[model samples]
Target: MPIANQNLFNQSRSFYLVSILELWQRFSYYGLQCILPLYFVWQLELTLADAFRLFSTYVALAFGFISVGRWLGEQILGIKRTLLLGSLLMMAGYVLLVLSTHKNGLIYFGLATISVGNGLFKTNPVALLSDIYNRTRFTLYHTLACLGSITAIILTPWVAHHYDWNIAFSLGVFGMFLVIIHLIFGKHYLNQYGTLTDQQPVSLKVGLLVSAIITAAIVFSSFLLHHQTAAPWILVVLFIANILFYWQKLINLKSAMRRKMMIVFILLLMVFVFFTLYLQIPTSLNFFAIHHVSHQVMGISFLPEQFQALNPIWIVITAPMLAALYNRLGNYLPIPHKLAIGMVLCSSSFLVLPWGATFSDSSGFISAHWLILSYALHSIGHPSISALGLIIVNRMVPAELKNFTTSMCFFTFAAAALTAGKVATQTIAPLYANSPYISLALYSEWFMKIGIVTAVIAVLMVISAPLIHRVMQSNQP
Candidate 1:
């Protein structure tokens, strides 16, 4: 091969390795996610409020600890080793999940372990890819993640139904095992990359400090999972602390960089809002599907978890087209405008649910088509905001701070997950005590209120797009 061609091939090879790892990692993660609430409700016999609280806390901590993971990768282990360590930890977590089928207390520990491992594993690969490639690959990578999610959403539930939850959880164990095996075999391709910390010698003090921090984080995560009521206060404190930390950091940057960082913070807030709405999928929406939506479509029975597949399935269909359109439009469209469009779609998704409720049959069960439509809109809206938000933050931050900034993006997600949990616990869970028909009406009303609020936000975002766009285009630091 020509020199340029060989380099391109090698880069592509490395990208594929990272992307595939993401694919399987998401497979494992989403597989567990799809079943977790159900597991808490049915297997562990928790109330809806408690279930959502645990689920949200687990999710919040998973993303929350990404900052710690990035620190480890940057300051101690280097990205490659950190990634390996995380995968191994995730495998252990999954193993504990399988064991939890017999010993219920093990589930909290299992979830805590997975959360920490996810924190470590999530951002490093993207950081590694950003180091090697200049072009934005967020859409492509997210599509791969969606693919993994779709497969997991479909299969995990089926496995749990046909076989057992232990076997289903074991699928995650197998997925992580594959991730570890692939990482080991593929390390050579990535050796030239993610080595920023490899040359630095770790002192015993630093190593011990890092270990202590990780242990404390795990313990805190497990505590939150077990003690659901404490989550709200803890999340609020974390959220405020994150904002203050970023605010202080933002003011210290050069003028142009400061402006860009300001926009990044704005976008992150938007992400928090977006995910707070989107996360209803695995919690309230899943419950809605099980209780209110018709399970039979064309004489075929579908599991509630299987319906979660619709979002990813829609993404798989729409992502390439959206990517192509974005490429074709080039700089004509700004990121803020795209995000505004997403917010509009998200609002519309919920708005349609209330309208769809009117068409319910005598049994108070709505057609699955309503959910299909809702998910379609939700999926299309995701890449516009979440994927672009990541790309924007990655582009705006200083090189040294890239991993940390990326982790901060995940931190917004963490806050959003916590908020979503609160929403579920406070809003949706209470409706569960009502009859299904009354709950359906109340759910629609709540959905309408959310839709209206998001619609208002979308309008504001649209109005602000030009200003944000101009700021983004101003002089670089």
Candidate 2:
């Protein structure tokens, strides 16, 4: 048997070498996200509606690519080749981004390229880590991954707000070059983690059908919900077809007969609901921050994307403390209790942001400090949910199917972004059109309303928490 790598804590080794390499990739990814809106509006001169819609589409499409990636990793390419090609594609993407920004239509094209690269690259990194560590140690690996995300969130906005957006994007180009180096040298560190789930062969036709069907469902879901938009007729038809295909599989699979699969599928659906609300932080909140809040600190105006930086900042400061607290509380405090508390914390953050929105007069802007607090509270709320989520999914799924299941978890995230786009069209768009200045107050009211909804989700989760815990624990050896 091949010797397992030594423990990271005991040895001078860490997943950090890999984490640092991964960090640069995220630096590029989040850095681009930070500047995308400004580039669209300030540089590309899109209307706020146009910019928001387009931005929403870019993000929706980004996560959507992961399903494509998951397939290739399993069937045709395998994770190693897929991840390498993805890394190179991302580098070329950054290069193309620089090249694309100068030409019309090219920026979206460039983002699509980068998003595809991420679909290809992002999934495998954690899968690689899984190959190295056990469930308990995987917590530490996840912490490292979370750390990278936090670093990107804080730094991306700071780079953009401090410098020009193009310069911010240029930093991505540099980050990608670094990724090329890391992937080349880190071959020895990574090659051991061979593709675990690639053994279950899936055909290209099946994969393509899956993609086509999912696309159709999203479209049909939008239509069934009475969302009025300019989507073409052909597109709508396809959307319906895709929904039917998935619905049939869901019914036929009798996943309940497979206990673990049923629980996972349900959890994924709940996560979808969570993501719909959460994804709004990027798209809808962008406008909410730009228009509603009052602010000035040392003459710097806080932007919406900057709000996203808040959660990560919280994670960096609070994760270790929370980890420590969990250790101290272990064997006494119930996991459900901890989770419920976190969910309440999450809802209140939104509640606070809306309060700030309402407080701002049509002409009177609110201070950035309000936003800062909102973000901080959100930061606290996130790690609580995230830590629990990973634990549940990892422990419950069959060992061999972990990659596919994890991809489903992220798929919820992507689905949420897509749902948020639709929600944006429903809530924010109409409110803005009807009320205009009055919409600010309406949104504040809406934020508070959403908080109630989130609190309910938290409450429901709390009530069900013991049951979930029991189900998860019983499934394990």
Candidate 3:
């Protein structure tokens, strides 16, 4: 058996290189996201629903196509080339976004490029790191990603407000350029992780042919699905396909494996609900904060995007404590039970928003503390569900199928993004259109409804914990 390597904690040079590169990539991505919603609504003149739909689609496809990127890296471009391509494509996407300030048709095309580029770039570095260290440093990667997001949320909006939107986006483009330069210089560290001689390789001709066909198909689909109304149906079709594919995979497992797979499936459902609720942070929740929350907190005026920093800042501050708690509680509680607690906390986060909304004064400015508290609640739940979900996937899935299973797990998030978009369209879009400047009462009602529905999901997760525990016991490693 190959011995497991554990050098990640040692802070090796290669590790720092990859981590820094990954951090910059995340910085560029989230920096844009910090301003993307307002850009769509304010600059593009899109309705709330349309903006959210496009955002949802962008997020869904960015993550959903990671599997495709992995395949292309392994089979055709190799990891180094794929990474290079991703950086270029993402930079191009940012440039197009800036140009979209003038020409609108470039918006979707830009989003599509960024989505594909992110998928290709994000995970491959981790894969290389895994090969180098002989272990996965998922948490470290996640922490850095969150830190990047925090920095972006704190700075990007301030830049856009003080300077210009194009300048803010140009900053993102510059970051990507730095990433490309770093990767090109430091790429030798990743050479050993590239396609191996033992692995079956695709012919270049065949790979190019396949890529062309896929591109053609995507173009045709975009043409057909040009209407905003058609976006949800596309998501529905994709969701159904993912479900059917997962079911087919489950059929071939032995009885024990099947039970474990079922538990994984159940856990994935809980996570889907969690993400559906959590994503409001970037979409509807941010809008609410900008419109309703007091700009002056303790007599200091802050940008709306800075509000997003709360959740990540909380996560960073509390992560070590949470890690220690997890270690102390190791196997004392079932994973399902721990996840149930997370779901409950997530539900409570939403539930708290309504109460916060109640604090709005006659001028419609509510204390930012309520939103801060909501973010804190969400930060607690975020790791509980997300981190544990990944750990559970690694532990429960069969060795040979781990990568495939993990891809499918990410697919759940894509579905959740789409679902969240649909929810926003139904709940938030109408309110924004009717009120233009939303009232405290409408905000409270909207928060209450989502909170109630999410609470029901939390309840379901709690009730199912025992059953999942029972199945999990039979498949314990």
CA RMSD, predictions in order: 2.9, 5.9, 3.3
How would you encode candidate 2's per-residue C-alpha lDDT over 1-477 as one tens digit per residue?
A: 245466546521325545655677777887777557556777778665666566655665567567666666766667766667677767776776677645655555566667677877776766555565644555455556556566666666677677755566677888778877877776676655657544445578866864564445334433322322432233345444644543454455434424555566666665666667666666666667766665455687555566666656667677777878988999575665676777788788878876676566556466677777877777676666666766767766666567656756665565566566666544454523654556566567767877898888888877887776666556343
RMSD of 2: 5.9
On TM-score, the stronger of 1 and 2 is 1
Question: What is the lDDT, from 0 to 100, of the residue 443 in candidate 2?
Answer: 65
Cand. 1 TM to true fold: 0.92
Q: What is the C-alpha local distance difference test score of candidate 1?
A: 0.84
Runs of candidate 2 exceeding 4 Å displacement: 1-14, 74-76, 135-164, 196-262, 294-304, 331-339, 357-363, 397-407, 425-439, 473-477
lDDT of 3: 0.76
Global lDDT of each candidate: 0.84, 0.64, 0.76
Better of 2 and 3 by TM-score: 3
User: Candidate 2 — which pairs collide?
Assistant: 213-242, 216-239, 293-366, 294-365, 294-366, 294-367, 295-366
Q: In candidate 1, what are the lDDT values of residues 149-252, reduced to their tens digit?
A: 88999999999989999999999999999999999998877766776686567779977887787788778888888887787787678677867887888778
lDDT of 1 at 208: 86
Q: Which sequence of candidate numbers ranks them by lDDT, best first?
A: 1, 3, 2
Off by over 4 Å in 1: 1-11, 136-138, 199-209, 251-259, 395-407, 426-434
Candidate with maximal TM-score:
1
Sort by TM-score, best first: what order?
1, 3, 2
